[model samples]
Target chain A: LAKTTQPISMDSYEGQEVNITCSHNNIATNDYITWYQQFPSQGPRFIIQGYKTKVTNEVASLFIPADRKSSTLSLPRVSLSDTAVYYCLVGEDTGGFKTIFGAGTRLFVKA
Target chain B: DVKVTQSSRYLVKRTGEKVFLECVQDMDHENMFWYRQDPGLGLRLIYFSYDVKMKEKGDIPEGYSVSREKKERFSLILESASTNQTSMYLCASSLYLEGGETQYFGPGTRLLVL
Candidate 1:
């Protein structure tokens, strides 16, 4: 299992774009990068996932470098409600019990 | 829109008591997992089941056990709960896709042991 490291906290104003980066230096060849967002008192929700290059969805975007050792999660047009803890995970396609979630980046969107 | 439902949102239990946490998913996924989330620990997997009646231990499985009787239901059992077991218990289900698997989580159960 690859351990992930990210910022403890971040601050952003409403309508601004925020990018959170995660480092997984020991990522495996078959591992994929995934991002999840969790609000207070709620379970984490999937934001985006990617193997390499960039992947975009309606909620967020995931950018993975060629080495696959690092990834960035980009949230566009932030709002107060977007304040949450974002987690980056690296694991195999069927990593049921092996998926590791480290202390995620807490993003505070101010209005 | 995959939905995972937990048995309780909040629970209180006494030390040495037996605690059971139930999770159900309607998506019929083949894989279900049990994890505990702490303040700085983020989420630690307790156990996971890939199919019915099969389970695998995760990183921190010392005080926890799991059962998967059916494909849609997974249960976490703590025989003798302690104050240290108090935390947010999360249940998730995921289907193995071609490239990767995306886990869908329930609202989570906040367990407090005294």
Candidate 2:
């Protein structure tokens, strides 16, 4: 498993854009970058995933650099409902299923 | 939509008592996982099953055991519960993808042991 490093917390206001970066220096060639968001008491929800370059969905966009050692999750026009803990995970193809979560970045969205 | 349902939302157990945590998924996913979340430790994997009756120990498997008799159901058992085991228990299920697997989680079960 590739270890990821992200900020402890971030603050944003409504209608503002929030960007959270994650560093995985030991990322493997077969690893994919995936992000998940967790609200107060709910399970973590999948936000975006990408192998390289950029991938966008209805909720957010994932920007992966050419090196693939780091990735950024960009949320546009944030709202108070966007306040949650964001986790960046590097998924590896180990012929089996496994997921390890870190402390995660807590995003505080203010109204 | 993938729905993972846990047997209980909150549970109170006594020390040295056997505890069982049940998880069921409606998506027919091949993989199911049990994890415990603490204040600073984040989520630690306790056990996971890939197929029916096929189980694997995760990072923190001590004092925890799992059983997967059916495809959609997975159970985590604590032979002897303790106060230190009080935490938020989470269950998740996912399809087996090559590069990455997107896991859908349940609401979670907050267990308290005294």
What CAPRI grade goes to candidate 1?
A: medium
Provide the TM-score of chain A alone for each candidate, in the order shown.
0.96, 0.96
- Runs in model 1 lying further than 4 Å from the true structure: A95-97
Give one digit per residue, the lDDT tens place, for model 2 in B13-104: 99999999999999889899999998867788999998999999999999999999999999999999999999999999987565477989
User: Candidate 2 regions off by >4 Å?
Assistant: none
Q: How well is each residue in B1-114 modelled by candidate 1, as lDDT tens digits? A: 899999999999999999999999999899999999999889998999999999999889998899999899999999999999999999999877877888999999999999
Cα RMSD for predicted model 2: 1.0
* Per-residue lDDT of B2 in model 2: 85
> What does the i-RMS of model 1 come to?
1.5
lDDT of 1 by residue, A19-110 (tens): 99999999989899989999989999988888999999998888898999999999999999999999999987654547888999999998
Q: In model 1 chain B, where is the ten-residue run with the lowest total lDDT? A: B94-103
Q: Each model's C-alpha lDDT?
A: 0.92, 0.91
